[model samples]
Target: MGFFTDCSRALLTILSLTPASNRHFSQHPLALQDITIEPEKASPGFKCQYPSLKGWTNCNGPNSRDCWLKDSASAQPLFSQYDIHTDYESVFPQGIHREYWLNVTDKVISPDGYLKTEGKVVNGSYPGPLIEACWGDDITIHVTNYLKTNGSTIHWHGLRQLHTNEADGVNGVTQCPIAFGDTFDYKFKALQYGHSWYHSHYSLQYPDGVAGPLLIHGPSSANWDEDWTPILISDWSHRSAFQDFYVELGNSTSGVLGREPTMQSIVLNGTGSYTCDPSTDKNCLPQNKRKPIFSKVFQQGKRYLLRLINASTESAFVFTIDNHVLEVISTDLVPIHPFKTESIHIGIGQRYSVIVEAKPSAPVQKDGNYWIRTVVSDGCGTINQSKPEIGVIRYNAGSTALPTSTNHTGLSTLCADEPPENLVPVVPWPVDHQAVNDVLNDTFEAFVSNNVTHGALRWDLTDTPLWLNFSNPTILNLGNTTWNPEYAIIQESYDRGYVYIVITTQAIRKDPSKNTHSVAAHPIHLHGHDFVILAQSNQTYDVSATPKTFNFNNPPRRDVALLPAGNTGGYLAIGFKPDNPGVWLLHCHIAWHASSGLAMQILERQSEILPTIPSLDPTRKTCKGWDKWLAGHVLDQDDSGV
Candidate 1:
């Protein structure tokens, strides 16, 4: 039997052996906050709070800082707390073990030069803590929530949760949000290797700052002398994400629909210069602290691997380094054939790994610095970025001067995906011609309209916004006949066959009399699977003729892809195998669009999933905690229940 099968049988045996008197159980007391790590030592055995629970054990490890970096002559070798040293070959061999503890909390600070704003951070740091592990390692992360107000959950972006769906970390779908002062353990194997991020999946929380980089060490397509930490590129706003969400979804006096709030600036690695209006603002300049510039020191003729992640809530970005060429190696978590490009386009929640050779033949200014530019793509949204969204790449380590390096001319400002031909996966996903015999083709129309009953503007996948029951996650609702299918798309017994879905979006006016309508591209993200992009085009999809144009042989595979929303209508055709049994979410990565209800659920192999997850006790306990909290407190369900 496989691991899950054995686990299922063991769970059944344990339950059957237990006495009915012990059926009712309570959670362990609030997890202690002191997570300091120290030298290994054994303590006297402590009595179990719940002796009836067979596998329960006291938490170990001295409570110290979870992530830290050591000073180096070249640069700070970035790593998590437990990883004092790392060797790629040994750490990521054929198989290995990895674990971490992440504490989620709220802090008030200005990542940029803007006024102070409340940020939901992980491990007491903005842009959260870095989660580093080796490929094929059995990764375990104990996430403790201390948000004080909102519950939190972290989604490890682009990591195919495989059969371990509960570890997907999507609140309201895979599991309930970890309640304040509660902890949830996420365990899954890192089967794929590349760079991505873990961010709060709870509604509007990630944009408020609960996010961090996740890197899985493995083989790279190209050689590099050193690999720096992942660079996070994002759009910035002065107000909280929750506050901005209200403007997009709230009742409007002006009758305009789908107006995305203008962002204050663009941020690169949580640092930017936001021009503060001193006349209108009291907290103008924060005392004695300059916005820290993201800097990288380079030695001539050496190659550096830079992992780029677009963690923006809405915007797509075009990233370029002044007078430099980037050798692109991977997209999302899929390693691709290396291709050279001057710039690369990245959408929200997407990632790319590229190599840069710091050759002395390149431009070396008197200042010894070059600007790393990230421009918000056109048609995504508007932002008041008077200064460029840039980081500094210094030729010398000791140089503190700014660069006069100029951006490359005529770079494409359009919000679109990289050429499909350039993104061929190094490891191709097999396409079975006979698999289509049992295909489930789903078509959804994307639209923006006014919710007449609620008196707010809303975006729809197919006229319904996803409103999940926090107290009853879909994973726990397996085999539930009473569950509604309005927002859920059910797929069963495909095993390893194709499940095709095509999403099309067109410009639609809130007021039918007006010719103008909201039209912009959306970056759609899928949980639990890396889907094959069969076709993506700005032209309208014809039911009969579109299938002929589909790429059946080794299509571009990724977890996130752009669904073009143009005047003529954009369509994205994607296919994935239903080998992984779990409840999955497909949603637009745009904060505004997803909040307005442009999303859906896929319940795959429900019967199979039930037998695999025989012990639903932890899941039940979480639901109970959520239920108790909901009974006493009122949570406004303005946004989609991500």
Candidate 2:
């Protein structure tokens, strides 16, 4: 069968298998057993009753401002007999299809009142246009690269690309980069729901500006009066990331070690204020010519849902609003039990869905303006001209005054995630302890080494630092028995059982130079699955004792988590079922670290992948185009090629 034909067949099968009675939840609206079947839905199907503001019998539907479709108070399933506990890996609603077209090009832009000569953006905007969809919707995105010299690919951050590995979009691991002027169509099912981002996976591309917000609307654990667009908070650099990479790599000729690039300012949803002296810098815009301050209007007593994403090149932030309490609803793509906090520590590539009640502290100003702060976490990274108060929240819609509210006191500056105990998943997933011994026996040590990749300093999560060939991705060579060592492949053949992997910053290997020790936290992200955090600790991993500390009982589960920084010991242990049969990239979300080889590929059930994929013609065609473009071009592959 042809590729699209297979996808169509799968969708049809899903529709046919769904009991007609359950389509509208005609009976047993909250009963989980009523939806039982030999096999569950995995593909697109006929348009079913999606969550909407109108016509839902029991409660407000998914699109309602006051409540999410099947909220905690409704007692109704999220969609057609499915609730929070339903195994999302196997079942999803038969949602409609969503299509989008993005044109990537080079342009001169000023996101922070300073012009960037080498900016790359999608559809001519930084933090590109929002891509929204309903849960279980089949999405098709056509990305055409118009860069004068570079190839590009967009990775759907935090989306579990189940059964659709080809659409995962890691340039060298999934498919070759989309050659200049060539369009690559990415097709995948919305297996998981929540807000995330889509960014260029090609080296240094996303940092330049090729990224945008992606929202897959679904059920929520908390109710809100309004839903806001995703707030993308990032550390910005005046220079293009490509040029800054040279400083990060350092001068090998002079024996100077590479240093982390310093960011100039913080941008919230693509706008920030930078102090520039026009006398010294002609690229800096005058105060009158600069963009206005980023602000959001809030009504008194109304609760609002806010989606926050950290898309920084190398910084973690503490998100907060002065004088207002935050109710965190979800972490990453997983809905969690609501918890109240003064501030949230967010790592790179991490996302949070929080609800903020519009009640200000006593003696509210007549203008009622509050500051939205994205404070860079100390020790995690640094910014040259750091500004925590990058935005404003106004209770009065017409208020143009700056906030006079004082920041909440006692906010920690520690560079770490919210305590693991606080991030309780609403849907409990009890991890099996059978693999405890296996995980302890094969723990992956993450450390920095200067010996790898021609003496350039590199970070390694495995024995070897990852290096990729753009012309040869792992998907194209799935049938091979032994893979290239530089690919950093970890094979897992289990199709039904859970696979637990422990990653630590403590150096396990003996380094004669003693330069392998690094006290930097890494935001480790795994594609294709939302893994359970079995254990996260700042202490050294004791093989025999640490196993006892594992939280097998429904620990915090997400796509990304911070591996704490420590010179001697700090570790993050995660477990996931290897049910998906494809190659998935697991790497640090830090742009510089990833390019420096802190990455690896997981070949899960490789033997089962080729037989499922009907054709590689689409993959081959893009590679051919890339090869053709490269024949006449002289672009050097300097970084890890993503």
Best by lDDT: 2
Listed in order, each prediction's TM-score against the native is: 0.82, 0.89
Q: Mind sharing the TM-score for model 2? A: 0.89
lDDT of 1: 0.71
493 in model 1: Cα distance from truth in Å? Answer: 3.8
Candidate 1 per-residue lDDT over residues 1-642, each given as its tens digit? 001123433553454323323332222332342121121211222111222223222222223111111112212224211121222211222233456899998887577776646777889877887787644456779998888778888899988776578888888888898887788878776666778999988988888888999876555666666777787888877788988887776455555564788887778888877766655776566435657788888887878789999998888888988878899988998777789989999999999999888863355577678898888888886787735647898988998887888888889988899989999876666765444433324676677654532456667665456767766788877767656644545454567678888887753222333222357788999888888999899887777687788887778989999998777788898888786778889999998878777788887877777655546677777777777766777787777777
> Per-prediction count of colliding residue pairs?
6, 1
Q: Report lDDT (Cα) of residue 412, candidate 1.
A: 94
Q: What is the lDDT of residue 127 in candidate 1?
A: 89
Q: Output the lDDT of residue 203, model 1.
A: 87
Best model number under TM-score: 2
